[model samples]
Target: MEPHAARPLEGRLALVTGAGQGVGRGIASCLAAAGATVAVNDLAPTRADAVAAEIRDAGGDAFGLAFDVTDADAAQTAVGDLEIDILVNNAGVPPGGGRPNRFAQMPPEDWQLQIDLNLAALMRLAQLVIPGQAERGWGRIIQISSGASSRGLAIGVAAYGAAKAGGEALIRHLGVEYGPEGITANSLALGLMEGVGRAGDPAVDRLIRGVPIGRLGRPQEVGEACVWLASEAGGLVNAQVIHLNGGTVFGR
Candidate 1:
């Protein structure tokens, strides 16, 4: 038996949204390490550039892209010309920045923002890339969803959870629609992560205790899952939601 080799994603081009930091950045780095050329995208230009530079410094191929996923025109302009083999929809806003309200009390604008960015943005980006992918006969779409999408632990993020649920459904439909074209659509429902820059917070202790693993998931773990799904190893897998929550919630 021979030792397994890395670089399974060699010759692939990946575009990861909200990759300036957190899980997105980790996924970009992991894909790059696996020999994929990555486009590190974020709403802030500087953040995106920094991440891309970090990847380059680590001896990987990557570039920065700053664009709002919610902006259809900007998304089209940013991605229209690229031949992306993998798309990771990781951009989204968490609820409750002095705006924590119950579903009934939440403002309409807040709901719209969540839906537009979380659900609609994924659909729009998929539309833009699906054609090229279909033409080439290979593509991977990975949605970075949340545990709230399947559970009712949304609390103040009712809208966000709702949108994520919708996104999951859309991913399923896309899988069924495009599986014949060599495209796979799936989602990753992440729980409280250690690499979201929120490690060591006392507030997260309870959440960590709740996990079956008794710890928060690392960003690199999520990245590894993304790489596996994007690689040839996961070609037959589609329309599935892989929950990366360390057994925080199950039975979906």
Candidate 2:
């Protein structure tokens, strides 16, 4: 067998948003390792360039593209004339970055921010990439969602959950509508993750204890899942919400 035979994503170009740190960074690294040239996007130019440099230092092909995913003009120009075979929507408001407010207490403006960041931004990028993908007759759309999309959280992030759910719904429709054109749309509803999960923090012990796997999900693991979805092996898995929450009951 050829040494590079295991690189299923060879010759593909992947664009990963918010890839400066945390989950996005992990995904970008993994995609590059899987033989895909990656375009790392982040709001901060330094971060995007840093991650792209890391990938190249590791002997992979990548470049940083700094732009806010929510900005329509910026998002459009970022992908101009580039043949992106895979699009990983990983940019969004961090779980606790937004003030926690119940729907009743959340001001309309605050909730609207959630919708714009989590769902609308995703739609914008998809709109920009899907046409080219269709023309090529091969594409992969991987959405990084949250467990809150499927279950209610008592933490006052109703808007966040709703926005994620909305994105998933869009993914379902896209999967069905474009399946005939060899494009697959899928959502990965993630559970608590290592970097994002705040593992070892006493405050979240109860949440950790609830996980059957007795651990937190790793960002690298999420990247591995993306590789599968973007590879030939995942051709048939479309419009499905796959959970990556360490066997949480909510996932089941």
Off by over 4 Å in 1: 1-5, 94-98, 195-201, 250-252
**TM-score of candidate 2 relative to the true fold:** 0.94
- Candidate 2, after superposition: displacement of residue 38 in Å? 0.4
Give one digit per residue, the lDDT tens place, for model 1 in 183-248. 999999998777433657676676677889988787899899999999888888899998998777
**Backbone clash count, each prediction separately:** 0, 0
Cα lDDT tens digits, model 2, 1-252, are: 111657889999999998999889999999999999999999999999999999999999999999988788888888867888999999877534788787898999888988988899999998888999999899999999999899987788899889999999999999999999989999999888775445577857877788899877788999999999999888899999999988894431
**Best prediction by TM-score:** 2
Candidate 2, residue 249: CA error in Å? 4.3
State the C-alpha lDDT per candidate: 0.87, 0.89
TM-score of 1: 0.93
